[model samples]
Target: MNTINVVIIDDEFIVSETLKSYIEEYTPNLNILSVINKPNDAKEIISKLKPDLIFLDIQMPILNGFELLKSFEEINFDIIFTTAYNNYAIEAFKVNAFDYLLKPINVNELQNTIHRYYLKKKNNPLFQYGQVKSLLEKINTPNKTERITVPEIGGLTILQTSEIICLKSDYGYTDIYCKNGSKITSSKALKHFCSLLKNHPDFYEIGKSGIINLNYISKYYNEGTIILENNIKVSVPRRSRKAFLETLQIQ
Candidate 1:
């Protein structure tokens, strides 16, 4: 088995050391190339060493994980985010198909993640740099409305958030309907998109498995159903009915 070169970038010394020890103990095939505690120095070290994988912390003083990633013009290496962020932020990671470990990392989870990484490397040698780039763009641009990157088999499809008509959850995947009558199926879960579009004024979660663009809503029935553009109809659950009506300012 070939050894996988790894780098740990965390501002906290103890956290970084704990992760280092965990990798050394649990994953013998993984080689710890470097343990960087300073976010400022990470760029230079990572550029020089060019490890196969990086375990990056999201919260740091000088530069956070997203900011550090933005500094890199091209992300050739794979990233495994290590964060103590809340559920909303974790959803972003899931939507982007990025692997992440929560703080005080579980040994079993870490091992499993590494195993998955090995399998991914074996099956698909090419890393999806587009995902990382899209994530960075979302993080860097707070004012602008973010575009959604739909991950297809061959590559990624960037869609303006406004162009989305509605999304329906099919098992674990999401089917996105667009205004131009194009539908894109994404491997990400519905809850991920829910979190991703939570801040958007137009996008609203109507039912357990459906999200609708309020701007495209053409009709709403008192019986708890809404008709959006393209003749797409979605049911609004009782629990969400009040809030949905309130959003529409329907007295």
Candidate 2:
């Protein structure tokens, strides 16, 4: 059995310790790397150590686990949120977070989560990395040009791709803001829409989770963020900043 590296992010010291002990006692092959209390600290750990598994807590004073997860945009790790809240499970899974375990720690449930995590990691390479890549490929499929299919809450709404002001990632869905003052959520990953819309020359893949319709962009400021024609502000991730700027001339 290969050793699985793990990190625990919870404000509760005892809970972290408990899970650490449980992992050590039952899963001999699982190595407990480090337990952290701050969500921000997890970012540094993630960059440096790159732990395969993380036991994250949903509710925290500052950033919270989900925000921490969102901050990364591009995650190569598998997460198991050890939260007291159950209401956010649906939302969490939407962003591709693998599993959730409620607090007051059940050993059996923890074991089950670990088992499921391994299975998912082994089986779904698409969920881990390929899905995002596949979606990106679809976005870059088209160099530049025209209209996009705007999926609404009720149904599909076709809108000119050049009229799109900005794109935002909500959970797993993409919200498209158009020049007509209408906003619609795409029924797929932002990357999916990016792939399909990338056919339009005016579209720019701005952020890790956003694509901006450059024709509607008013100005670029504060490094990577831009103001759209509709007065909407769209952010460009540091990773995609260069490409976003370069794509501005695609038309």
Q: Estimate each model's TM-score.
A: 0.55, 0.49
Q: Give the per-residue lDDT digits (tens) of candidate 1, residues 34-82.
A: 9998889999999999998999987565466887988898898999998
User: Where in model 2 is the C-alpha error above 4 Å?
Assistant: 88-97, 129-251
**Model 1: residues >4 Å from true position, as ranges?**
139-251
Model 2, position 125, has a per-residue lDDT of 44
Tens digits of per-residue lDDT for model 2 on 48-158?
888877888755545656567666767787677775543334344545445777656778987887787777767774455544333323333223334444444444454
Best by lDDT: 1
Instruction: Estimate the overall C-alpha local distance difference test score of candidate 1.
Output: 0.80
Candidate 2 lDDT trough over 10 residues, lowest sum: 134-143
